[model samples]
Target: MLKRRLANTDLEISPLGLGTVKLGRNKGIKYPTHFELPSDKEAAQLIGLAKELGINLIDTAPAYGDSETRLGTLLTGQRQDWVICSKVGEEFDNQTGQSSYKFTPEHIQFSVERSLKRLNTDYIDMLLVHSDGNDVEIIKRFGLLQVLNDLKAQGKIRATGMSTKTIEGGLLALQQSDCAMVTYNLTHADEEPVLDFAAQHNKGILLKKALASGHICTHAGEDPVQASFNYIFAHPGVTSAIIGTINPEHLRSNVAAAEKAILQQ
Candidate 1:
């Protein structure tokens, strides 16, 4: 349960954040297995369990179906108790299982406004551009980062960032924003520069796909989740890793593993 300030922001996120992808979207995901959506009661219980287990950061996005709405209802009165990290730019359509991206300033503004209403919050703790792999083009051409910063100045968002795909994009995001989300785990270390730069420049860093979207394999008698936590938390640059799951046992286990992993730092 190690909490650290997310770069220059006031949000103190835990090393392990609860990802709400499964809480909202059950289709068009990259997980190894398919599953039914959890009941509202179950979803609320899982989120409460995450908070009880000392998770302070909760990652959600508009693309995550109704995650923001569920979280808003669940965390209603206890808003100040947790840090909510939501995204913009990319949206998902559950009916057709199709996702669309728009990085224009107008879309960015609209997305933030909609997310604020959906989450029932006046201000977002963290906001990231849900990239579509065209990271360079988005940053260079769209000027969405400026819009996020403007929102930050307007007090609608506390921090700004991008969920980048390429290392170059990751580095550039660090230079321009308060944080950047990158893929880093036992399987994928190609984005280390992003982590390294974040560490050096005092920028926030969040790890995505740390468990390889639940596809990581382990050796006999070894724990895959614990191994992933150890690998991710050992890095000082990592602010948090977004792990999406709806199981209470899995959340407890991951939190325990993360607590142990962070102690090593």
Candidate 2:
């Protein structure tokens, strides 16, 4: 497996990362029904598998119901071996069964503290601000950039970034915040400019929805998982892509694709 250096950070992560969105709730655009909410035992197995397969990064968020908890349960004793990236500014309401977005500084702090508890780690490797398309207000109202920097100084988080849905949002975030940024590849090819900017600025770029919610490989005749992995690896600016798979076979195949892609590179 190939390791890429995160911009402005000491972290070096594998190109393919494990995403835990599906492990929590299934409200996204193209939710997979192949797996149920993973138990702590299952999450431990998956984390161990990911480590053996050379995957270094795991992405989860507070909005992902029980995902942080499960990750915490699996990774409690092995904190130094993996790069765990989680998000703030969004909370999952079990009663409503929906995600509620809030970006106030207090909320950000509260979310981080809660995430720390759930992940069972003292410090998060990377912390991203969950976005809802309104970048300016989100930044101003939350004072997120400053708060994240403060947390970094306090050693609660190593790095900070935003998880945005639009290229415009990404670009704006890059200009305003010194932290890294994440975006989905499927709906926002318009993000090429932002990606170029990040590369030039030496900022970390994490990719989500690289599989287009499994639509890309599903549309192609090739194995959807392999195709999705290969497509993201073909991009130069992508530092890492998050993939969620519960089936051991599928996970192994995805890892194979990642290994082959690295060999080809």
For each of the candidates, give the backbone clash count.
0, 0
lDDT of 1 by residue, 146-237 (tens): 89999999999999999999999999999999999999988899999899999999999999998899888443467988888899888878
CA lDDT, candidate 1, residue 211: 88
- Provide the global lDDT of candidate 1 against the true structure: 0.90
Tell how far residue 105 is off in model 2, in angstroms. 0.7
Instruction: State, as a TM-score between 0 and 1, how close model 1 is to the true structure.
Output: 0.97
| Runs of candidate 2 exceeding 4 Å displacement | 27-29, 32-34, 176-181, 184-188
C-alpha lDDT of residue 174 in model 2: 73
Question: lDDT winner among the candidates?
Answer: 1
- Tell me which residue pairs clash in candidate 2: none
